[model samples]
Target: MSTSRLFSVLDKALPDEKIIQDFSDRIWNDKELNGTYVELNNEWKFIPDNAPLDIVTKALFKEYFEIPFGTYKVMVAIGGNYKSGTWIFDSKILFCNALS
Candidate 1:
């Protein structure tokens, strides 16, 4: 997807709730990460791996945000469609505070 469109979808998915917006902006502006959304089973899933958006977001949260290392699944709706993924975050408190 185009960079503008990606940020738009990310904003819709994650919203502009303080740190969440910071995190989303980081992902959108990071030069090293060339991530994209892919359609799977009629849903768009962002999987964390060595490549793509999921891994990039995971790494950013871990290193930049200093979130603990673990896995967490988060889902958000964009334009009546759902986007879900597994994110790496060890602390439930941190997750709740950061994303809630």
Candidate 2:
């Protein structure tokens, strides 16, 4: 009687290939914040794409947005608003007078 596991046999038959891991910082267009907004992990279930690969790819990169410094009531998630993450770049406005 043969008792070899199917996954084990598949692993042996498949060749390892280099996978390009390019992740964007912007959230994917889903109801849930699917980008850097959530804590990243390798344990994926009920999510699209391969769990391990998807987590690794998304977690590897980040995007920085240059937001003007001001109190902004920004919407984080759907109907979810927050004020803490707003950043103000006041230095640019302050230094512009010197250049003139």
Candidate 3:
């Protein structure tokens, strides 16, 4: 078969808490008829900063946050819907954070 690619950009508002994140994953999937599926691969790199702290505690669940005044680079690979091994993927994204 053949392959296709797609790309998009999104703006997400953070909770105001000191935190940053790299996100990825499938946007939609139709499993019953095996019709459609999307995949996202995300990566993040942060500049050295003292604002961010890594805290580890004894708990079943943990929360993560980014430092208030830090900058970050987020990269993502989006896979578009397709059938079989041929992949129809999106262009990709390199997002830079502008500290608010």
lDDT of 1 by residue, 1-100 (tens): 8988876866565444533444455334544545434455697654222222221131112245646542232332222222344643332111211232
lDDT of 2 by residue, 63-83 (tens): 266445321211112221234
Clash totals, every prediction: 1, 2, 6
The C-alpha stretches of model 3 lying farther than 4 A from their native spots are 1-21, 25-71, 80-100
Candidate lDDT scores, in order, read 0.37, 0.25, 0.27
Q: After superposition, how far is residue 32 of candidate 3 from its true place, in Å?
A: 15
Clashes of 2: 2
What TM-score do all the candidates reach, one by one? 0.21, 0.15, 0.16
Of candidate 3, the 10-residue stretch with the lowest lDDT total is: 53-62
Deviation in angstroms for 31 in model 2? 32
Better of 1 and 3 by TM-score: 1
Best-to-worst ranking by TM-score: 1, 3, 2
- For model 3, how many clashes? 6
TM-score of 2: 0.15
CA RMSD per model (angstroms): 15.1, 22.5, 19.7
